[model samples]
Target: MSNINPFDKCPVYETINLIFTKVKEEDAIDLFECYSDPITKSRMNNDNCGGVWDTHNIDAVTKGIKGWVQEYNDRFYIRWSINHKQINKIVGTIEIAPVPNTTRFWDGACQTGILRIDIISSLENKIVLSEILRMVSDNFYVDLDIKNIIIKATKDDGERVLALENNSFDKLENSTFPYSDYYIK
Candidate 1:
């Protein structure tokens, strides 16, 4: 299943005024910084993980991005770093992965989108989140694609969930993967 090709050209997500680019080694510090906030990290990693503050694992983060890039190059996975142009910082990440074509019954299960966008917990940033979602939805397009998208967030991530819904995401009840959707799961 590692043969899909993402568009070589960078896609412009105007609402957020950022370009979706492959996650790179250089992104380690920015990502760590964004994930450093206890609230932000907990919200994204279910509070069970997220030691980015004290345990600033730059090597691990860089290696993770390298692996992601390698997987993208092989078409096994796709990961993008969300650059917040307004602040000139890397705000968060998004990804898509092809279901492995293995003997598992769910082989060819479907492509899935995984997104984790960081935003200030203010009312104004809620609008920013919505705009970001709009840009993401409009700019994302590729083959082996799935009709549904998923997102993952903790219970405290209500604002993000709301923003995603406002932009066209439906939550799946009794689901258990960060958030219930094809894009963020």
Candidate 2:
């Protein structure tokens, strides 16, 4: 939405080959198609595991993607559609948030924290992830002065884990939530 150039050259920051391009509102439909499909949803079993669920009802998903773009377009960082060069299709999405210097998660010695990334299973491969992480680490994360990278993906999301491990993502910890209450209620 904003005219900010996400791919602008910066002398202070080094650029990674993978570009974190903003996902447009119009692209939500395609995402829904990918995310809602049985094969696609089965590949990644996060919150949207139950076949898109009712969260996609009433245009909520579309609105959320668009709003996220507007909010994080020029913020410290944000997510982007993972556009594979060979495939030439946005097989997945990833988030890169630049942690503030003052956050409690900082180690004091590091000026910047980590850039978190999220991805779908469609792009889950060692080679594919290696290229993407290289792009992010070299082009985006390094420029942000970040020392670490974090990823939030599902356990069944093999591609994300494979890519994360290939990119040197150590497991922080495990997080669990009571799902039946949220869904049934």
Index of the highest-TM-score prediction: 1
Candidate 1 lDDT trough over 10 residues, lowest sum: 98-107
Q: What's the lDDT for all of these models?
A: 0.56, 0.49
TM-score of each: 0.69, 0.59
Candidate 2 lDDT over 40-153, as tens digits, reads: 545433432234433344286587577667646444345566554554555556555434423422223434334434345445566666776667656554444445654454
Q: Cα deviation of 75 in candidate 1 (Å)?
A: 1.1
Off by over 4 Å in 2: 1-19, 38-58, 73-76, 100-120, 153-158, 173-185
- The lDDT of model 1 is 0.56
Q: What would the per-residue lDDT of candidate 1 be over residues 154-173, giving only the tens digit for each residue?
A: 44566776776677776657
